[model samples]
Target: MAWGITKKITSAVKKSAKGKATTASASALMAQREEARRTLLKAKGTWSQYDGHLVRGRQFLADVVEQKKTAHTDGTHTQADGELVDIDAYSHAFDDTPNRYSASVLELFLVQKGLMENSQGETYRGPYHFNSATAVVTGNPAQSAAVQDMMEVLKNNEGAEGGSRNHASAMTIEDMRKVMAWSYKQCPDELISLIYSRVQSESALDMDNVILAQKHLVIRAFATTGFTIWTRNFELTKIRRKDIVWNCQGCPPYDIPYDLLQDHEYEIYPQQQTPEICMFTHLRAWVNFLEEVLLRRPLEPDEFIFARVGANSVVYASDQLSYDGVMKMLAWMCKEVGLTARYTTHCFRRGGARYRFMFTPLGQRWSLATIRWWGAWAEGESKNHRDALCPIPREGDKSFNGDHILTAPITAAETQELKMSFDHELNCLSGKVEEVLDKLTLAPASSTYSSPLPAPSQPPILVSSPQSLQPTLCHQATISPFLESASTPSMIPSPVPVDSTSSPSPPAFPTTRALPSSSRQHGTTAKKAAPIPGVGIPDLPRGPEAWRTAVKQWEDPAASIGGKALKDWPEEWYTGPMRTITGVKRNIRKVIAMEFYRLQRDEAIFVEAYPEATCGVKPLFDAVQRQREGRSEITRRATYITLSRPAVAGTTFPGPTRALAQLYLFIRRHSVLVH
Candidate 1:
């Protein structure tokens, strides 16, 4: 009976222990699920904030379309009509909405998905869509075709046709020039006031001038640096006059600052800074505009460069101008000028990049490395190594060495010269008009007096003025003393003096004059004359005497082609194969010249050593050509190997040195052939 009672108690104890464990496990599982739910809710809230802005952007676009339709029906939709709506409404909806996220979020979207951001954090904005359809209808026909072509490219849904809804349209040089010309003609005062405000503020305080100034600043920045609208609108701080270089710092990948609170925990990281040199002229303009017009004087290092200019000429210092403001200003300018091409803020960046790549000379071209750095492209390990090795934009460098791909900002000196030229041309035209009027006033009002004055004996000189100085829409010829200063001797041939007895003849068109084969300039030798076109290669030297001459020529610096220094030969001879030669210590040209001389002296010895060269002069020449083609590359590889070797004196030979040693041994083996 005691054993049965003990068995029952044991069973009850086992059940209680099992039930306690089960209850604990259920509670833990429920806690985990609740935590997951909270995390998901947080993420959803963040995304909802972003999605809310996008939805508002879509609604704004719809509203604009409706407004345009209404304007059309009322017959009030004209190009000059800037009063479509108040700027505040658009600004509030797109830029300053409470639901909007930070600028970094917009940048992230752009980088990851190719979705372009406007004042609002949305891809499709009103001005871009509206202007894309309507802007091209009113300008030049050729321009109209170009615009259509670009629009078609943007509109094409096929990936093979180089079209994408995500990609922005690019403007060509001709397109920019046309837009500038049209803008200048339509609103010269406004444009001038805008640029003028950069230097002199008191004269440019008018509301139109302030608005135009803001627009001009954006245009100049785009044309000069290919800055994205986000970078231009949000990233520019109160840049000092001395601060020519800009450094972007923030999150990895895109390098833009993000709000740590809203971002995922994993995404919150330290800032990484990357530096870019600003164009000199553009920097100058920006500094001046910021200090003089914006009145951001004694500029704080972190102060924003752009500000808001409100109605009644009120300037707001607290707020930064939104991407919407820039878009609206540009849209209004296009409409006012009747620009035929569709343009958006992104067009400037795309156009600038395309222009630099296509039109510039090889020496002035931006390498892939430079472009990647400037554009803040996706970084990799290889790119990081290359960036470390490159020596461009060295410290204390103040100017772009010689790059002219970016439209050079009009310097004060250049602007003054243009103005003077225009004045001189104007004076000449005025004088001619006055003379004609005087002649008419003096003549009798009779049929015989109607006869035209005897034509001038000499053909009138047609001076070519700078394009900037020329009158818009009207082409005219003028004679001015300023033309003498403007004309280059190489471009315009001196006029032959006409004899009094000789019949009048038409003026000769200017022809390019060939420079002398050898000349002195500024106490130095001038550049060498180019080889005559269509000329075949000259016969090379032969025998002992020829060998001596070749050696002497190689030793003499003046004998080098184009007077290039011995140290500069590697770069000068750089071809596709020569890129392998990273750092050559000696003169490669001299080495090649010496080899050529040795081969010329003993052909059989060279042929025996290098059997692939075969027999005859053709094969010999071919071998030399091959060596010349690869010499730079070989030298570079050799240098790299030498540098990489462990520090032990005379323990290892560089690749090029080793090759040279082998060649020496071969020549010694065939010494008997030389004698």
Candidate 2:
């Protein structure tokens, strides 16, 4: 009878599962009741025979779920390690936001791990899930509100949602906008404004619509720059996959931009282009919602593209950036990053042009004209003055830019070579000047007012070179005073005659920003000054344009003219020394030598002047003097200068004069030691 009852109950359950009313049938209900009675009787003699056990299990499960879902505001529990823990651990699992997993699964796992226990003791739950609460305690109220809004946006855009139950991996811009709008709904307008206004250059942001868009702007700025921040434009933008070509066929009808060529070389510098990697990392994470994920479709030209994250469904796209907008963004970033010194979005543009023109392997040295047309200078309209800011060189300095830079102390050996090269260059210019002056002085006067000198067999002094007469070609539109100085009027000054033997003292120093012409034959242009090779722009005294002409004419011997031409000539015909010694570097070593001399040659003065500087100067001085005289000291007191030694150790030194005395003594002693 019991087995028959169980069969009847099973049939009723199956019918119910199939959405039938089998359990409601009188015969079925009666059979179920009978089955229950038999089960109870069977359980009475088995492990599951405990009364109320089944009821307890259901109640426990319900209570467990309840505890997790309820909010806990206070922290009143302690762990096994006796550390205070927040009560939210059990409660937070119930939070509806950022809920990516099932509470049931979490509860079961916790129970298996012995983290929690059911009231009936049949199941265990893991540690309380409130660890995040401690971290959340420090969160800004504004941030919390913003996060909530973002959560709401996700809910509104279910298609992009990637919750625990939903394992969807793709997202789209429309979905992200939905989530972002929801997340910001509850946030204060001020905080919302802050997030939207600041944008970095790497990514496009709704710049006109947002407040406080600095974060986005900063990221974008970083993106536009080279891959590494410290290296300053060492990398270029990565080519998209579509640009890659596998064909080996030649003769494509159209020419590509210089940058697009695989191995194009600059005419000047011939270094090969280095490969660069893409800077963007995860494409999906950029947008917060899964519904916003892309479907991974191939890109097609002219297809409109929108940012993955925004408040709007439609966004304008552009292959080229709006120059004005980008400049404003760049200025904002420069201020944001505290780099008031070197940030200009346009700087990157100019830098791109310069990097191509100056640094590339097909390295072509750009003419000023080419630089102006690169679109960089058009935006730099206000900085027109910078074109003429030529770097100046010191007298006799042969360095490329005329500037000598020594990061650390240079050795005497290096100095000697530097000095030799510097002097040689100075001498060469000075000699040329003298030679020109002599020729000028010997010429007879031939002004329109004065009678012409007897016709000589030599040619005229001002004859033009064939090369100078040709029209100057420029690749870029050159402007500014420097360019004008080089082209409009010859950069070289007109040469005047003078007496060679009575050459005047050189000028204090010569510095000119005026550029020398690229050619001399075109009288409209001046001769190009020989740049100190290997150096960039530098300042140097300009040579007279007519010097070459004068030299040629002087050699001809028929060009000499006028009485007392040298009388009107300026005194300083030659440029003075390029670099002068700093008083410190010059005086320090000399002082050492002077001190040694005093110690060896004048013991009385050394002892008196540097009484506190030495412990036994008199005796040491005697020894040094004796050593100098090929004799030995009579006293055996050990004496030598050390870091702690008082140069005036024996007495209270007066003002700076005492210091000077010590310096002198030190020099004297040093000189003796060296000898």
Candidate 3:
């Protein structure tokens, strides 16, 4: 009957899982259909102003030309009128005066100031008045000839020079490399973490590194898709999968505008970034991170794409990020990446165009016509538009050698060499930063604990393993002085010697999330695992009598995980270094839960929220007292055999003719020690 009930529960769980899958699949289908609808709108070329003809009068009146040229008295843009202005206009001024009356006092001022006038020396012949105090544009062009000429000129110039650059500077692969280097710097991890002495470029991070990945994911997507789309910065801000209103501004292309991608929908990083700098990979990663991991739910249509993320993780996706905010970040990236060219949002369009026109391999290069259309340039727009955005580099001396990057495709070997060199530079710089930060955060600690080099007299300090040192009752009596900066000198567990023949220490349980287990130790190819101390847990139930002593550790594993109240710990633990430490005395409870591991030299910190989480030497000896107070030999022997220090004193069960459990335990300990 019990088995049958268990099966029924299992069936219900499976059905629930099936229901969830169905819901997710439906979301995906809805998103796909929404994307299809958007694609149709883009193909039609005026999605924002759909059915706008109906909004204006559908009937063709005698003054149809005037009706079309001028906006409605209610202030609305027509479909054709919206098309006449550049699509980028939606980002800046969605509402504006009718195109016919667009010649404003401000326009006259700018034109008079030499900022807005045509460089070809053409003037607006239409009526306008400019005095020193104020300027006014002509309201009514009663003379039909001047209006027609002005209208024709305006029509010819729409979207012609909107995103064009004067001194065109394309972002080369080297520039992208710098941006990527900057991205790695932003992401604190084994890859570019200050803590690690060496970093591996080729080594991939697990998709499960949710917190670590999210911090960098925002900036990475900004850099990657920012280049790939070649869109305006404001358009880049519209990269929401589920954004409602402006989703159809232009294509990044069209996955995000309707709603976020559903659960299990997007790929993780390193899966696609084989070159260590891939646009598609980072873009997908950023989107996926928002939905599946950071938010832990599909984003609403109104959510921010790059939510307020910090060094830790996403803070919120509440507010719409402004273009000025984005531009400010772009400015920072330009400065930090060491690009001499002051890049605006226009650089993305310009740089991408240059790659298509000149840098791409000859046979695969984009045609001038395709480039024009791809960039939303209108018909009859020629080579000069692309040339202005993506001009060939000319030497100071006007030598043709300046265009060498355009003529020659870099060999794969050269690219790889460059990547490795960047990796080396990243490691050196990040490693130094880690050192400085370690010193900065640990600055409050006394000099004795903050010292870098271990005194020559002391034994080489093993970080976690007290078994490696025979003299300790604790897991580790002291960390190396450099690692000690994270904590004050007092919290270091004072030694309380245990019987040499006593039980082995339990493996340290980390407050921080566990890194992927690695064969590589510190200062190796892989990332260094956070310096977790090998501390013994309070209640292992040394004897059968001790089992029912309200040792509620296994009852709720997480309760003890953060650390039980200081009152709950053995009285002996209240003695020694723990008693002396002011930090431990202040806290009521020990909470070992860490949002993220610290980036410093090798050491585990008894951080805020969990001051006394670090297992001290006195606690180990206190636990041993449980073994000596056995009610019977059966319980006593069991306790001794179960927790016995395996390497030196293997489980003393039936001696030479050992129990299978004892032999297995013996073998396991040997294997651990060997590693």
Q: lDDT for every model? A: 0.40, 0.32, 0.42
Clashing pairs in 3: 241-256, 242-256, 242-259, 242-301
lDDT at 10, model 1: 72
- In lDDT terms, how accurate is model 3? 0.42
Per-residue accuracy of model 2 over 29-103 as CA lDDT, tens digit each: 688676677665675456354444434544554575466445333445544568554444443434435243335
Task: Please report the candidate that would top lDDT against the real structure.
Answer: 3
Model 1 clashing residue pairs (backbone): 136-340, 581-636, 582-636
Q: For residues 59-100, write the lDDT of model 1, one tens digit per residue.
A: 654565466666566534433435453322333334445433
Q: State TM-scores per candidate.
A: 0.29, 0.16, 0.29
Please rank every candidate by TM-score, starting with the best.
1, 3, 2
Give the residue spans of candidate 3 off by over 4 A: 1-169, 186-215, 243-277, 292-294, 307-318, 361-364, 369-373, 378-675
Relative to the true structure, candidate 2 reaches a TM of: 0.16
RMSD for each model, in Å, please? 37.3, 32.2, 25.1
